[model samples]
Target: MSSSCPTNPSSSTTRPHTYNRKQKSLGLLCTKLGVERRRIYDIVNVLESIGVLARKAKNQYTWKGYAAIPGALHELKEEALREKLEGSQGVNAKVWDDEDDDETLSNSGSQNDKSIPNSDAPKSHKNDNRREKSLALLTQNFVKLFICSNMELISLDDAAKLLLGDAHSSSIMRTKVRRLYDIANVLSSMNLIEKTHTADTRKPAFRWLGLNENQSSNVINSRKRAFGTDISNIDFKRNKVGVFVNGEFSQKPMKQKELEHVSGLGQVDKSNLKHCTKQSSRSYQFGPFAPASVHKVGPSENNSVKQVHDWDSLATVHRPHYQNEALKELFSHYMEAWKSWYSEVAEKKPLHIL
Candidate 1:
């Protein structure tokens, strides 16, 4: 028997349900499972990919229940088979060579692809750069690995090797692993699969939750809890009728005076009222409709409107007395000398160099 196989199948089957659907911290899971944090992460990633776990927040996951696994696996299998058929039929005629895959992987991950629009053109070119590197697309491929393969529990190293092939460099493999880690974290949060140790070697692996025998029962109970009696007693109603005049769809209009009155009432006065009020009194300041005299600034006080100062005039104003007379004279003499030298250079004929 392979070391990856679970020694105790019963314990493995019941382990996921023990956590329930509550949000659990990664540390808590690690402590409970008696596994290393890194190993727990490996397990969480693969489980999350299949929709059994969902991430609530940082280092926290909500179990979505294992009942969703069967349906998800079925859908994934169908998709895989469909893709395989399409490939055989030459539907995807573009042969993805090693160079192309490397280039696509390199360009697609890590950052947002934004294109600057040409102002001269009426329509801007659509950015096709994002489609190749989309997280959603990466997630789909990651899930496809489980659906297409016969292996029940796959290690991250094995998965990376299989997906990228042996031709890819170590750095590329590392990049692929990092992307897989992200995908796995998201999938674990969804509760599709869960981390587990293999039976023989104690190697950390992801066990698919869909294969559980108790899934149907759990799903039925969950549905019952969610819907209660509401689903069985649904009441359907007819469409509401609108007022129609003659052949045209029209309703009675309000009088102009009435409309104006309503509009006036609807308009809220946003301007703040200024008034001297005692702090102790509750009714010291009047509301928005306060008298004009209460809002007026006092005659002795400066006007609220700002006075614009002439900064440019101040900047241009010369203060010759503030400068050193000797330095100023020397600068002026140098400026005259440079001006004369430049003028003489401009007057001279162009000299040809051999």
Candidate 2:
């Protein structure tokens, strides 16, 4: 017997019901939970101590199969009976710490002439705490934007546009997108992020999940409460019609005489009149039509908008490819000597409101 992965009983009651006795590798679970592999093994040991049965599936320990335990509705409602799913392993300190380690370092740095240390350098525990706090702020902002946008999930491009302020690095941009994907995967595993498919069918978009029955019910109820309070109606005939009579189509409009000849109007005028429909609007003469094109700026146009660039330039000052010719040559020499990975961070685009 192995340990049971934490289960949220409240989740069982409120989350959308699914009866999948599926098996997933412990490595995959660790990645999703943002924990070390060894930590997962320790968790398995702890779960075995309790009655929660787990067993090795392939190379991983998955929840053991069992029939649904008989319990009354009152037992299900008892908050005490609900197991703590998220609290399993007694709070993973490392996962929490890894999330922070950035900001702690920044606050400790002095305004000395010395260049700021690269992210690769080792930092104290205090630095790690600061980093976690910074990550938290970023995550909170991202979540808030997602909720208020009234958009069902934004695309990767749109998401990049939102949180990452304009700072350019093709490699850095990819890294940020990858990091966002990792965070999203964690939320999705917890059933907090809902996945949506793109029109291409290959790419997926993630939205803040309305997880389970309770959440869905709350959303529906909220909409119902607003119903009939401020109803809007449209005048279909005038506003909805899309016919372009005076534009390009009118330049070569079929003359009445041409229609008359086609229908033998001289012999019977009513024959040509019968061809038109009751919904037809009167025709008018017009000239050639050409639609105007909307111009869009690409990522490189860093023309200082509102804030003159909303990014931490301090971070990019140390990059190998920065504008200084001497630093570029110096860094290039070192980089060429040893084939090590030097990842460039991508510049984020400005937030798109629409």
Task: Please name the candidate that would achieve the greatest TM-score relative to the true structure.
Answer: 1
Clashes of 2: 19
For each candidate, C-alpha RMSD in Å?
A: 36.9, 30.1
lDDT of 2 by residue, 201-302 (tens): 334566554222233312212211111111112111211111111010111121112322121111211212111101110111111110000011111121
- Model 1: how far residue 102 lies from native, Å: 11
Ten residues in sequence with the least summed lDDT for candidate 1: 273-282
Deviation from native of the Cα of residue 236 in model 1, angstroms: 39
The window of 10 residues in a row where model 2 has the poorest summed lDDT is 285-294
- Candidate 1 residue lDDT tens string, 1-354: 112222222232223433221213334433433334554444443443333333334433333223233333444444445545434343222222134432122212112111122331333112222322334344545555554544556556545555544355788678767766655543432333344545544455554332322333222112211110011111111111111111111111211122222111111111110000000000111111111111221120211110011111112112222122212222222212222222222211110000
TM-score of 1: 0.33
